[model samples]
Target: MDFRDHLRKIIHVDMDAFYASVEQLDDPSLKGKALAVGGSSKRGVVAAASYEARKYGVKSAMSGRQAARLCPHLIFVRPRFERYKEISQQIRKIFFEYTDLVEPLSLDEAYLDVTVNKFNFPSATILAREIREKIKAKTGLNASAGISINKFIAKVASDINKPNGQKTIPPEDVIDFLEQLDIRKFYGVGKVTQDKMYRLGIFTGADLKLKTLDYLQEHFGKSGLHYYNVVRGIHLSEVKTTRIRKSLGAERTFSENISSEIYMLEKLEDIAEEVERRLKNSRVAGKTITLKLKYSDFSVQTRSKTLKLFIASKALIMEETKALLYQEPIKDSIRLLGISLSNLNTEQPKSVKKPSIPKEEQLKLPF
Candidate 1:
């Protein structure tokens, strides 16, 4: 096979401290200061924090009180989810301008399969730089991008030069790059796995590569295959437009089965809140809300409501779910209560209108 013909070009883009950076961009005073965005209440966690705050040891998922203790000068602000959602949509629109093969990992990160693109650029490195420049000019925010032959390396390269930077790894240098990488830096190697690898004398990619496939498979199970392929710069995963959902459910397994109307209402409130959070995090809106119940003797029944439009918010989900839950009779003691949202919108790609190619040019390969 031709070397260039078998190669793939992928890019990964990630925003720097996305939510906190947006806050600083909108307010000049917040720049160059230790700032965090989330509730300051004792029960709340930090959703996002600026790099300045990170220097003081503040991090996301830590309790608000813990962050305050770590950085006495920390400035806490509430999350404006609506504003963040609007900005996310703007960034997504920019990705579409380059290629239709975008796979969003979250609100702040995405992967683009740009082996073929609308701009007719010869280098993925150049395309990445252009995309970063466009984002900065349009949003007044900084972004990091990585370009490489596959998604794994591209994702890692993006982080190599962070906070308004781009890095590219040509195919020839991929092996040397992987060999020197720390085992902890590998995608699936979390803290627990890192410790296990250390005990086994696998501290770097070189060490991991030296192990036999059988050895790795016996030690790490199915993940060994992933490790072997990625370390060797070989990946066959495709950027999928749609993925099947694993599960859909809503339930209230009550502490005690009660027949009182007031008691059931309180239980339903908790269930609705959980369902709403899951929908938003998954970026899915569902048209169907299902209510489930179990009797004291273990008999189960379900009722469902279908809406004309998809719903994603807590209030709307609760209203519809409560209505469905009440539709069924509550004659026996209820042991379990549940709610589920289905018929989610995964968002598919639109058809790209390819530019017409001349007969002579079409005969020769584009890349």
Candidate 2:
């Protein structure tokens, strides 16, 4: 394919240290401090940590005690999911104002196909700058953006200059960009895969591009196709907007096993709140509520109730979640508890059917 023909205007926007940044943004006192949001107890893990804490070798998913060992002065704060959700909505509104082709990767990141946008911006680079400016202006938060010919390059470009910065890669520069990138930096190639590739003498994009499809497939299975095309800078995945929630669930592994009903019920309330937030965020109403429990011995059991009517309210969800929790007798100490909402309604207004035209036939027609 001609480089120009394959050229696209893709933008990847990612919020820096999303949860931790939000906390610092709201409270000036927390700025430049080593902060973590989550449980402070020995059992709790860091949900997010500020850059200062990262300098001290602190990281998310590390146990609170471990983080303290790494950075003894780290401050711990409980997560405020509702507040984060509210800010996410605000940022999303800003994205929609520029383009309808926004695909959210998470509450804090998105990919936008701005080849044709509402603002009539002359260039994607300019549009990215404008969007970043708008986000910071409206939310008092920093966002990084990358503009490139495709999603792969755009995602990489976004992280090159983080913490409220933007970068763009023109179509002509795609090959040069990928050639010098470290094997570990390639999209979708995580630590384990990178180590395997290193042993195979595939240490760079240039190295990867030299491998035959047959060789890659023989080694990596289905993912080999992905690695093959990405090295050649060919991506056909569209910015998909029609996402359906397959499951809405919350789970927590306790630091210590608990056999008390009262304590377990309290934890269920927190889980129910998370389930409700996710359900409401997706605007999904569900019919089934499931309760999952894991015993101290690592055995698991589940019980669920299908409601007659779909519900999204927090109170109603908690009521059903709590009822399911007690429905089964606990034979041993519980180490984990979970709540899941499923049987979704994919019947949104835009989800309605439309006439389709084959790509080959449509291409034969002229504007």
Candidate 3:
């Protein structure tokens, strides 16, 4: 018997344009209209965009000015995070009714291991549907779900039919499903990696499967082996029920890149203060301070220092961020600045195995 048949059933659930949807829900006047939730200021970036806006090429992380140019009639609303958080809690309560093996990736997306569920259903597909219905009934928002043998496939599958949809990849179909997937659609493949893969003639899972394991390893290091296994539909990572807080960070993209050290340091101080406030609110302290700089050319660089003691004070965080910022001379005009705290006090759960491509390496799925 194929031992793979015994794999745990996993489900990935994602809310549909959560913030924008909520705005539409609470105010019926906004229904069926293109909407984006975020500051509409010159330097503001979109936090979320509704499906209607998406049709016009609006997207999250796009600057408000660019979004306006893309969708002439796009409506911008400031985010109400507290309201979104309240709805998230309501949906999570429904998830817990089915399984305790829930790992939340963000306020809008989560993974659940339902191989053995509270309802005693053998079909994860059914559970996913019922949970989505419950969410809609309780929150008046649409959610999409994907059921598969592992988190990776399930998460990717969730995007297949988005905005109130679901898809399931049976165990027997895993290999074929992946073979047909586009290289750009793979979970951890960013623009840089995608371009590299294109150069290597790996454009699909089928193409990736043609390379030798040694060849992959030689090219991509440990992550190469990871890609090899994923293409073959083999991932051993488990759904983590208890997750540690990895980092607390905030970033701001500017309307125009700034090259002046004085201006850059001023922005860093603002980011550091926000990060400090969030750390205190969460009651977590960290020893590592990271400074993220995004250049005008779109290239990104991060500098980090792990201190001997955990500190959550704004003064200390700013002090460290400034040190890291000044340690290296400004190379180019910077378009963004961010500050983060990591190496937190919470312990990593032993039940879940870390992926070969670290969480930091994985790009947030567009879905």
Candidate 4:
């Protein structure tokens, strides 16, 4: 038998309309109403929308103005990240009671490895139900969970029964489950790729499985290999316990657009200082410094420089970012200034080490 056939069980847990739901829970009057958690300004985007708002075609990342136009009675609430983080920590504590192998995708979602759970449950499905119940009792919130053999399927399954529900795909059912699934549901396949797949007659997992690996590689390059394995329900990635920080940065939007280069330099100094503080708190350093500028017209530009050594000090970050600032002329009055550091001096423990892969090539684990 292939060793890959005996994979560990994984569960993906996601909160339902997390921010908006929290708002409703804290203030019962907002319950059963269209609510959005984000800025209500002209430039503000919806960070999260309640299920009620979603029914009106309001979605997260939509402009607040557009959301208002869609639902005239939509209620906008500011995001309280600190409060969300506190609740997330509580949820994590519950997960730790079952297993230490938990990968947090965000404050609202996480992946758990329950193949060797502390509770010694024989069925992952039963354990998922218990976890959901515990979450409701402890946090007074609804959570949906998806259980499968790997992260991708588990994550996708979690969405099937959302807002206080759960779904499971046993090992024997993996193949059939994927075959009936639409190609658009595949993880990492975005809108553009979905359209191209449609044009190529690959409309479902069954259709995707019909293509040869060589043919897929020829057309889709490296991602073709990922698709082939995923279609076969063969994702071997483990549930990671620790997350590595790949970059640290901060930015600020000014009340008034700055036209003078001298004033812009002053703003850059403050942003660079904030980046330095974050780097120190993380106890990490990076070799690349990127300077970002957004103009009044909403066009953005970024310049970066890589050094032979890692740096995290304010003086060095400011010096490097300032050097990038003067490299080009200010085309338009700048509205935002920011700086970021990448190429960190830390490496995540991997089941398979891929040192040759470019840092940018690594799949951004949702966090």
Which regions of candidate 4 fall more than 4 Å away from where they truly are?
1-4, 254-263, 295-300, 330-335, 350-367
TM-score of each: 0.72, 0.77, 0.87, 0.88
Model 2 whole-model lDDT (C-alpha atoms): 0.83
Segments of candidate 2 deviating more than 4 angstroms: 1-4, 253-256, 259-335, 341-367
lDDT per residue for candidate 2 within 141-252, as digits (tens), equals: 9999988877888999999998789888776677888887788888789988988999999998999988999999998899898888887778766676766566788899
- Model 4 worst lDDT window (10 residues): 358-367
What is the Cα-based lDDT of residue 36 in candidate 3?
A: 91
Worst 10 residues of 3 by lDDT: 358-367
lDDT of 1 by residue, 187-265 (tens): 8999999999999999999999999889999999999988887788877565554445633656655555688867887
Q: lDDT for every model?
A: 0.80, 0.83, 0.86, 0.86
Candidate 2: the clashing residue pairs are none
Cα-based RMSD of candidate 3: 6.3
lDDT of 3 by residue, 1-367 (tens): 2316336688999999999999999999999999999947455779999999999999998878889999989999989999999999999999999988899888999999887678777778888999999999999999999998788899999999997999998877888999999999887899999999999999999999899999999998888988988888777778887777888889988878899989988887788788888998999999998999888777889999999999998899989988998898878999889989999987655785432323342222111
Q: How much is the lDDT of residue 103 in candidate 3?
A: 90
Lowest lDDT 10-mer window, candidate 1?
A: 358-367
Give the winner by lDDT: 1 or 4. Answer: 4
